[model samples]
Target: MTYVKDQSFKQDSLEISIAEPKDYFALLKPRVMYLVVLTALAGIMTAPGHVHGLIGFVSLLAIAVGAGASGALNMWYDADIDAIMTRTRTRPVPSGRITGDQALAFGLILSFASVFTLGLVANWLAASLLAFTIFFYAVIYTMWLKRWTPQNIVIGGAAGAFPPIVGCAAASGSITWDSVILFTIIFLWTPPHFWALAILKSQDYEEAGVPMMPNAKGLDRTRLEILIYSLLLAPVGVLPWLFGFASPVYGVLSIVSGLGFVALAWRVFQRRTGKPADSAAKGLFAYSILYLFLLFGVLVIETAGALILNRLG
Candidate 1:
């Protein structure tokens, strides 16, 4: 009887000790990873050179791992602030599902592995960009800027924007004007996207001591900045067509979408002075997400169509 009880207790303990795969997956921030992968694919497709199927697959996989690693590290470092913010309190590290040390180790290992593997499979330029992206997000943005300045997202946006450039390098072994335009679009789009959320979550940032735009610069100023960025992003979206990479279909979609984005931002600016301003800000935030997805979706379709044409020819 005693032996059986001890055996049963040990079995229960073992079950409790085992961590689910999903918890590790959560550490990767899968939603953000999806965007990174899609944008990187767009970069690869838009480039003016060819990449082998197997090599491209490996490079994309490596890029994804690196992006996930950066998210993990950001979570690890921001666990304190994340715990305080309602939006992030349930994340793996802050929720006590994973310890900071575990997240840190996971991030570091993934970062090193992804960068090294990318270099082995692709060019050093792609790998170097990946390494810099990881460092920028993990250290520059998460550790220092997020807590220190309102412009954190503005400059740190570069980290997220680098995927297309990295993809271009992986595909062509060099970056070009087209990749730079892709980079510019994302970089400019980030502020308005995030600032809208900030307007909605000023209290969260204040509680977490994060110097988000609304909190640091006042709500009115943040709204103006959001409108400014939206206006800037409008023209950048039309550049791929002018540069001669995208088709007329992409051009039409981009122009219409950019106008819609600016109109939403204008609403956000106008309504920001009142009440919660929840409706306006939330509307912009939601539409901004769809805007990016649609823009990139068009790019993906165009690239696919071009590939089909090339094969047929």
Candidate 2:
């Protein structure tokens, strides 16, 4: 499918949009938003302070909206490239279900609303961090790094890693080492997790002129880098347990999951051709998502349980 540079005639022809609620919601990139909410919740619950239920709920809602705003803006700005890539060609803006102007307006409104709401309900530190995250993703990453460099995912990963820090600030009005560690885990996890998918989607990226690792660097280099990052991620993933913030249960689960992540990365690194290689990359991609979800999910559960037990005691 080809993307037309000028949508003026098409816009005049349509006059009325055929978009539905789900089409607009699709612009929010809900899957990524879910991960942001989960990691942020873990940060909020694990931080060393008591946050009132209503305040906590509002803070989380504001953070979610901020994340959604980032997603919308990213889609708006990347519509041309999105139209070129098979995986993203059907996205709301690229598919003409939502106009770029509408998406920009929606994203800008949500960005302002989320930041202002968080500042009023929580603290300004959290609000500031949320605002920065949106700007970094929409402007710095989406507009610049993504098309300019192969390290796009590596550097751009910072935007995705900020949610937990924002949550910690909202809950305690300060950034703790615990929240930083949460940020670190996600930061380290991003390269391998995304590079694995990049290995699989190299052609799509090449066609779209996005400088993803596998497209810019050779696949062998990307695979090796994926393994290296996976190795780093495994040990760091165990830090919360080692530091005593999380229980032994989390420690054991983290070790097991971390090992599994490395094993998948190794598989990707070893398989160098054809269907076997593609399958390996796909396995690593899928397992990487599960690996992160398990770690944060278990951390939240363990931390919340400990808090409840402490209050009872």
Candidate 3:
């Protein structure tokens, strides 16, 4: 629950343990990595094609590693600011468990390994996408946008949006409208999800000197932005079905989940003026993770089911 911590005030029992390799892995943010893998797998599955099992496995591994590389690189770059933010202060780099040099080396090695493996096992197109995702996340998002703009997550969100496209290219050696829609769903969902966390964590951001939306715009305006994004997300979530890639099952599920997102957004909007703002924002932030995961989970299952049904029929 509390992660690894061994502390005592008696004698010199000073815990000399550095954040283990596992801590570095945690820096990768496994929960986010899982989403990356899942959506990528869904894209590979939903696409009309055949891929060798070993190659598919390698491709996914490469994407996951690239994602972890991005996380480590981000931790390296944001170490100073991370030390000031409650949410990020415990990261390996900031906690003195891992040094920035170690992180940079780890990220660089993983990035090259991932792209090379993906290229050999899958396609050059897939490999290129993975490379760009890493660069975008490491350089663009972490180094450039994070400290400079209120729209940091809005634009930096593109880093997280690339996996499905990477997976599509991995399988079919190209991109498609369906993959773009998959990218769009996550893209639209990112700002609201992150902004909610930012709202509750505004002081942390401000203290860290990161220009988060809430630190840039007032609380009321951020809440309004959350609501607006929620409204846009509803239509985007159901677009797969509308465009004929998914079934009515996904359509219904998307609508229901989107409505839940809206309800939480409404609560956040109403609670923006009080000390309750933090609670409201935290609730929305937690639910937003669930909402996105479930939406994608259902999409994968329903899409797979449709394929099986069509085969049987």
Q: Which candidate is the best by TM-score?
A: 2
For candidate 2, write residues 1-313 as lDDT tens digits.
9898876665566658788999878988999999999999998998777999899989999999899999999999999999999999999999988999999999999999999999999999999999999999999999999999999989999999999999999999999999999999999999999999889889999999999999898999999999999999999999998988888999999999999999999999999999999999999999989999999999988888888899899
Q: In each prediction, how many residue pairs overlap at the backbone (N, C-alpha, C within less than 3 A)?
A: 0, 0, 0
Quick one: ranking by lDDT, best first?
2, 1, 3
TM-score of each: 0.94, 0.95, 0.91
The CA lDDT of each predicted structure is 0.91, 0.94, 0.87
lDDT of 1 by residue, 244-271 (tens): 9998888999999999999999988888
Evaluate model 2: give its lDDT: 0.94
Q: Which is the winner by lDDT between candidate 1 and candidate 2?
A: 2
- Lowest summed lDDT across 10 adjacent residues in model 1 is found at 10-19
- Which scores greater on TM-score, model 1 or model 3? 1
lDDT of 3 by residue, 97-174 (tens): 887888888888888999999999999999999999999999999999998989989999999999989998998998
Top lDDT prediction, candidate number: 2
- Stretches of candidate 1 off by over 4 Å are 1-18, 273-276
Global local distance difference test of model 1? 0.91
Q: In terms of TM-score, how similar is model 1 to the real structure?
A: 0.94
